[model samples]
Target: MTVPLSRPAIPVLEAGMPAPDFTLQATPDQNITLSELRGAPVVIAFYPADWSPVCGDELGLFNAALAELRRLGAQLIAISVDSAWSHTAYATQRKLHFPLLSDFEPKGEVARSYGVYRAKEGVCERALFVLDGNGIVRWAYVSPITVNPGVDGILGALEQMNNSTQQDTP
Candidate 1:
């Protein structure tokens, strides 16, 4: 009898790594491509599902921080293995200003690329990545599944990036 081999785990991408680009549906008629937003900093958030208590609060915190995030020149996008319709409803109900992308259909394909896919649970692990204007990841974090990882770290990372950019400007 042959024993089946389990696939090796894919480690999450870290700082100094180039972010993998992909286009995901934001709405039924609209698609958001990561590469298209290359000239500005980006905050990529991966959550397990839409409408879950923790996710709602996590995104709500981000929503409240939209002004600050934008002031730092970072466009925030939260992704999950939920359908576009589900995301639409959830965003509308939550009054979210940032885009919530659907990683459904192919089901967590983007999450897998980011190494945040929870294959056994059919969802995404809560993860965050801050990328510079050139699409190089500047900070990355993966929080436990049940914890509500707040925006403090995100704010710090954006602030650091903002300062670095200003210093680099001639």
Candidate 2:
């Protein structure tokens, strides 16, 4: 008798909707959760896998602008289907300062919850979500599997969000 494979359900996050909060183990066994960064804006980038060409470039952009993102009062977390061990190796290999999370258990729980996981391949598509201080999704971008999300576009969106917030304050 052969057992059938089951596909994971994907959760779609709409614009202006509250992002689901989760706590995952980061490198060095540190816990990183969305709620912990609620006072500041956040950019949650979901990628297919580490060490891939486009993913490498996308992450490199974040790595290179770590200080700039902090200056913008934004924190970043990159999630993937790879194991924490894989993330550790990748982080060390790239010398990344930000946490690269593992959504390996339950096999892409976070990715599926974020609606980026590709069930057949057991991998996530390239997706980006910008959440404001209140945890509302301000902007979202999901790239085709073969395409790379432009870094400038994401930066521009963050700038717009910052400007909007500034205008709202009395």
Candidate 3:
């Protein structure tokens, strides 16, 4: 008889921690490295799948809010366990302006690092993280699997970051 090894649960990342760096395929031929996006605020949205209803709505909401996100000086990138080909198709069909990075090869590697991977579901929890220009997490939120975490929280976090930056300036 053999006993099965259990994988430990990963703690969800929180504010004030350094955001994990990763390089994920954005398209079949292009990859985006998190570290390279430094010097500008980054918004990472991790959803369960690319084309599911909730995921679609959540990403579509983000897509429509791109201008506002840009005004806050933040770049948004969505992540999922879907393959690069799937992401490319989905992004094109949805007409999303932001990059949809694939966490597929290792299957949720980036999500696990961010503490958002859902093992049983084989997907990522609906989670969001706002990283400051230096790559420190400014805000983090994990919504229920069935929920669509709207953009208000992300915008608020960026606004708060902006305010703090101004306050810190002499």
Candidate 2: tens digits of C-alpha lDDT, residues 8-119: 3655586889998988768647768889889888999988898898888889888998887888888989999887888999989988889998887888887877777888
- Give the Cα-based TM-score of candidate 1 against the true structure: 0.94
lDDT of each: 0.91, 0.84, 0.92
- Candidate order by TM-score, decreasing, is 3, 1, 2
What lDDT does candidate 1 reach at residue 15?
97
Better model by TM-score: candidate 1 vs candidate 2 = 1
How well does each candidate superpose onto the true structure, as a TM-score?
0.94, 0.90, 0.94
Residue 134 local lDDT, model 3: 94
122-167: candidate 3 lDDT, tens digit per residue: 8988999999999999999999888998999999999999999999
Per-residue accuracy of model 1 over 1-170 as CA lDDT, tens digit each: 97642221588989999999999999988999999999999999999999899999999999999999998889999999899999999999999998999999798888888888888788999999999999999999999888989999999999999888789999
Once model 3 is optimally superposed onto the true structure by TM-score, how far is the C-alpha of residue 11 displaced, in angstroms?
Answer: 0.5
